[model samples]
Target chain A: MILKSAEAKPHIVVIGAGAIGSFYGAILKRAGCAVSVVLRSDYETVKASGFRFTSPLGDLSWTPDHVYQPGETPLQTPDYVLLCVKVLPGVDRAELVRSWLGNHTALVLIENGLDIERELADAFPDNPLLSCLAFIAVSRTGPGTVNHQAYGQLVMGNFPKGFDQHCEQLANLFREGGIDVNGTDAVVGERWRKCVWNTSFNPLSVLANGADTLTMLDAPGGEALIRLMMKEVIAVAEADGYPMPPDIIEKNISGTRAMGAYKNSMALDYLNDRPIELEAIVGNIVAIADRLDVPVPHLRTVLVTLRIRQGVDSAHSE
Target chain B: MILKSAEAKPHIVVIGAGAIGSFYGAILKRAGCAVSVVLRSDYETVKASGFRFTSPLGDLSWTPDHVYQPGETPLQTPDYVLLCVKVLPGVDRAELVRSWLGNHTALVLIENGLDIERELADAFPDNPLLSCLAFIAVSRTGPGTVNHQAYGQLVMGNFPKGFDQHCEQLANLFREGGIDVNGTDAVVGERWRKCVWNTSFNPLSVLANGADTLTMLDAPGGEALIRLMMKEVIAVAEADGYPMPPDIIEKNISGTRAMGAYKNSMALDYLNDRPIELEAIVGNIVAIADRLDVPVPHLRTVLVTLRIRQGVDSAHSE
Candidate 1:
């Protein structure tokens, strides 16, 4: 029951218009798809000015056809839903996605790490889910601007069926929108590979209270520790039946080294004295390793140190 | 034999008159000691304006009788030399001390750690070596002004000998000059005890990349890592036949907690992107543990991480 090329454009609803969400939404809008974004009230400036995308390929700007808050508008489920929120523990995402989920909705998650897909599936079992691994260094500069620091393609795949025509249709839509989308059966492996990079590099950046460049390039024992953490991650992934290849891990490490002077989000949060998304980034890795009977000694040590640094056990006095 | 109280004051030389050195030199001058300081040319502002001490106890100013650079002055050994340089690797401290080491010279190292005493002893075994544990929160405000942040006290003793009469005389001089100088038989032990506090807290502060209060009070597991690092240090000290009591360690931790919003020197260095004294603080502890056959897993991890952080292998690039 796939729609043909002569039919009207598919309606896409992009929730949480942060940097990545905005980037994809702008691209889709430029390609003649009807795109709408649900954003916070604070992002009114973005709605007014439209989004400006500066990339190595070229610069472009796009204004969404519609912008609405979660509860303010009479909602209609779109043909496609893209969830782009900062994933943290205790997030009420299931309830947030309830009104947006319809019989025909296809959802794609563009957040960091894995397990969120499982969490979503557990909550909304009947809905379709697709996982995406974004390699671009996109960050929001202002209300309606995303600074793409580096250029890379997106690898996506079907969640429940492993890979099918639905995944191809979605990839075709992204391709029409000028996004380099690779739809593959190995999407789960791709997501886990990205997880290995995040788990090893992100927490170390936070704990060292330094930039990514410092952690990857300068810190002693940093590279060795990163390799060890990645090795443990790969071991756990293999035990769980979704291991990353050695070459991919090496490429990820090398990519980070090449991006000199860029501070990871975790390090930025630490410098600003904000609570980190530790559980999602590193704690989950430790928990998974334990479940799979894999020894992640280096990650565990770093986890304990980060917890101590954050004062995890002490009751808040104020 | 101790020199009797006479009409003329004994000559005292203070090396590295930045803050702590200037504070002591100013006080010594006030107490009728002929104080001369060897300082860098950049500290000409302090030399021009004299030295100002701002403390809760009282405020005072003193103009030193003489000031000279490392090689500018004619060679002459003083009765006492107070070494106050910040510890760094390959600093050639032995050679620096040699220029001022006369037969009767009593060299007292009032620096941050205990290893300097061993370094001095190894360099000039015959000269009387005095080890001092200085507890003060003082910093240079300008060329000649030092801000006494909070507390100040000195625990001093002679190595390889019980309280020498000269030690008692120096203690009397410091006491008369309004300094809390405690002469103990186990000054080396006291020095290591202070190090246990620093080795645990200083690096944690640097790694946490926040004020002492945040790590000590606000963060979870903050105090636990402090305790764990201290435990490793204590084990190493005991293996070297100088066992530190749990109570002393507890007091140091509690004292740090009480002094909220304080930033350690290492944290300041990291913030300013200056080189840190990693070897003097954490590396020396690791070196000692290795030599003594003590397994210091926690310390080893921290040491390696710090070495990576500073790009110790690629120091020239920094």
Candidate 2:
């Protein structure tokens, strides 16, 4: 399943030109792959200015070779589609993917949380879908500009199945673009591992108002509490039959402390008064816990607190 | 015990001329009580402008009989001293109370949290130390003015033993001054119960940035998280032999929601960027949990998050 040099570049379509999608598309374009970005009304700004990426590796700016709008532009049915939109409520996001998905098209999900892929899989059982865990601190600082605060490799693989040649070929395409891509057979485990970190830290940072480092270090009983919450997450993950390694939890905790001044995306949303990804993050965790019949008191507590903060009642009628 | 009205009213010294002290002093003055104020140098404006209370009960403005600094005042122990200063870290606040505590003196501890009374009880074992829970949402709108948001009653009682005559007498005095007073024998329970409310709502409000009602209602899973945290607090309280009723927790939640646009004290502290009362509220809860060998996973998580937020470590070092 390992891809070598000189393979035919796949035509990749990145949905939603956010930080993650822009990062991926711009890099793929530099790797000699034909990249198409589907954008909104702001497409002209991005096309004219291109995407400015400031990373530790170096800085680069590039405009995608092709652009498309959902209804206006007729899509060519890309060889691969990267779903990069933030999870907005009531949006039939799966249908949007279906528009660009073809028989040979492989869908890679780069969004936060674990359940989106499962939902997509259920909706399109025959579609070849891969789940990816991104470990980078990326944000859109301005129009057509993304600031890469931190850099880590992307861990991705085919879900529920072993890695195939297509997955490796895509991984190779990412690697050629200077992305540290790890093609794992245990994509679910990796996603759950990432979830452990997200569920424990993201809302906490948001609730504490961009004080992730303090939450990790100085909060009264903070370290102990995070450990307990993560322990619950690990338990839930194990009960769900995709047990993440103990070291994964430890690594996340340590990595969070090491992150020091990095504010989580949830905190950013709260600051900007944007609707949070509460359903995908906290709500999904509770749903999974209910499904697995595991007691997740701490996670449930955080979830409820976040839900109330977001003004959604128990009925979630909003 | 109820106090029989006497021809000569007893002299009261309000130590700490902050918002609460000023409100009480102004009310007592209007009620024909002889009151003096001990305040910091920064509170000179209160002396110049007298004191004003704009409350739902009624608005009043009056200058106290005298305003004295700590060292400038003649040292004559009064019948009662209302200790109203914030709990500054490392300061032996209880010892500061000792200077004003005479054999017959009654001291009311009004700061947020529980253990301060315990510390005072250890110091002044003989004197009548009344622990009070103030429910009025009084904020110092100006130097000598307080804007009372709501008119909730104050609960007060003596320590260790059941309510004595002195507790009732103070309750009567407050009642005479148009303050709703609930004199109870279960002062300890009252304090712990108030702690439960403060611990749950205050930090959440501060973290969410003055949106307690919305955050508690709208934030995904916020209510559940708050309920879980309350359960943890109740468990710790029970283990410490101060079990709060579930109804009280429910009332606190409903009361907070009812407060609507009002901001909690923690939110005020955060807005002012002042040092938070983390130790008094969240810290004491964690400490008591450890002491009683009860698990408070949710409280611990939030406490840690807030601690990092306040830069408590650096504050401690300073």
Candidate 3:
């Protein structure tokens, strides 16, 4: 199934060479796995200079086994398919990877949003799927540069639960890659827990642009809004059949306070004028809240404000 | 008694010669009134080159009767004192204007805010206070230049009641100055009416920086928020003993829509890095809403966000 030994290295085709994809690809390469990447803006550069990774552990540069653009066909089917693209609404992602993915390949999705695994799993029900959570602070600084500022780990489990040997094999690949890879039987709980942090900080960081986690918390009355957002997320998650913990709000607040000044991905995206991960992160929760008849004024406000910004931008373009 | 004739021009003291004061002073001067100004930033420039008025009506440049700093005492009390300063909290306004105001000087308090009349009236009980509102698109472009783009009028009334002879006289002065002046027995009601627009646009224009009125209105969910703000303002005003009409929200929305692209004074102030009149314009309404036990979550959120911006600015300064 997965990687048996270092001699027979599993070949991985990384579908998105973003910060997450690059980080994982570099780690997998270091773990003695054959890694190839399909990139958007970084194909030419990565093919030339390779990936330059800067983490707290150390810094290293390495070239993957191969790099290809979207149109470039794969001559061979890889053992694992890693999907790390930004999951904005209206993108046909299942269609994007179908050309290279075969029946025998397993897919690992390491994204920071809600309900991202549904489409891929539905597209390939027979294929092995490991829904993964990448708890790492990473950013693609340049063409071949990946900066990991803080936490780095992979919390993975069998898609729809109950870990098998395949889960162990895939996670062991990451473990052998010089990063912690923890397994959980309750992946939905982990997703909700991750959403608890993402929903609170992501949109607020974008809306409250240029402010970090602590700076936003220190904002006047911001502490209350942040806390309310966390509570609302937990409530919405519960209503949606995956409840977060009771102490999660206090825990998140104190934990973020300790993280000091850190900009979430949404903030970075907004600053870079990239499309925000609104629907995947905040909109999904709001949709669930709407379906469940739960009032999440704070979260709803963030959603509406972002819609306004998007509307303004579109109007400007037209 | 009021002025006997147009030939007997009223002498008025214009304190706080910013945009509002300068505009009113220029208008009063155009109406054949002798206007003396106490200026802060524009003193030297205005002294060197008198005010240049560029309105849709005409163009004119004229020096006021006198220009003095705040420390410079007036030789004598004038017939009227136009208090056009920003009505922010924490400053002793009464004491600031005490030296220039005397028994017969009817002070027309031209400001944009809630609960402004009480303090001035309380501080100078015997003085005739005309609570006034300016409905116009005007801004000070430079040191001695005012840009009057659209809709110019003065809606005024006696501080606590029906129009007195002084109010009539002041109304006539503005009328002769080529501007319409409307009088009402219910000044508070009119204030609430004006607030329907101010509350919707002012802070939003600032917070949603670079966004004019229509752009904000055209924002995806801005229509609902704007309408809700108008409704909440009406409710708060009613709780404060001043009931606006039922269809005022629609009326305000349509009126603002028709205004096309116009930035509120608060927005201009924010863009220029000048301090916003948060306490005077929005905070006072939120306070009243709190007192009346009215749940105005939207307005309260606006208040808090502005406070957050203010807090961030203060922290940056420190």
Which has the greatest DockQ? 3
Q: How well is candidate 1 docked (DockQ)?
A: 0.22
True contacts kept of 3: 0.24
**Candidate achieving the largest TM-score:** 3
Report the poorest 10 consecutive residues by lDDT, candidate 2 chain B: B1-10
Q: TM-score of model 2 relative to the true fold?
A: 0.87
Give TM-scores of the second chain, every candidate. 0.90, 0.90, 0.94
Native-referenced Cα lDDT, model 2:
0.74
Error of 1 at B163 (Å): 5.5
Error of 1 at B40 (Å): 2.8
Q: Write the per-residue lDDT of candidate 3 for residues A226-288, one digit (tens) a residue.
A: 787788889988887886667888888888888778878788887788888888898888888
Error of 2 at B221 (Å): 3.3
Model 1 / residue B235 / CA error / Å: 3.6
Model 1 C-alpha lDDT per residue in residues A147-206, reported as the tens digit of each score: 876754788887743766667777777787777987778776776777787887777776
lDDT of 2 by residue, B29-94 (tens): 655677888877535876787777777777667687778877554356678888887775676777
| CA displacement after TM-score superposition, residue B1 of candidate 1 (Å) | 20
- Model 2: per-residue Cα lDDT over A1-318, one tens digit each: 113321357788898878889888877776777788888755888777778889876775677767777754434667889998877677677877877888778888888876767778887888788888777778888888888877747888887657887788888877878889888998877767877877877777666656655445556566676777788878878987887765876787677777675667787876776667877876787788889898877777666656554552223334
Query: CA lDDT of each candidate?
Result: 0.73, 0.74, 0.81
Instruction: Pick the winner on TM-score between candidates 1 and 2.
Output: 2
- Model 3 C-alpha lDDT per residue in residues B186-250, reported as the tens digit of each score: 78788888888888688766656546787778776688777877788889998889987778887
Going through the candidates in order, what fraction of the true interface contacts does each contain? 0.30, 0.55, 0.24
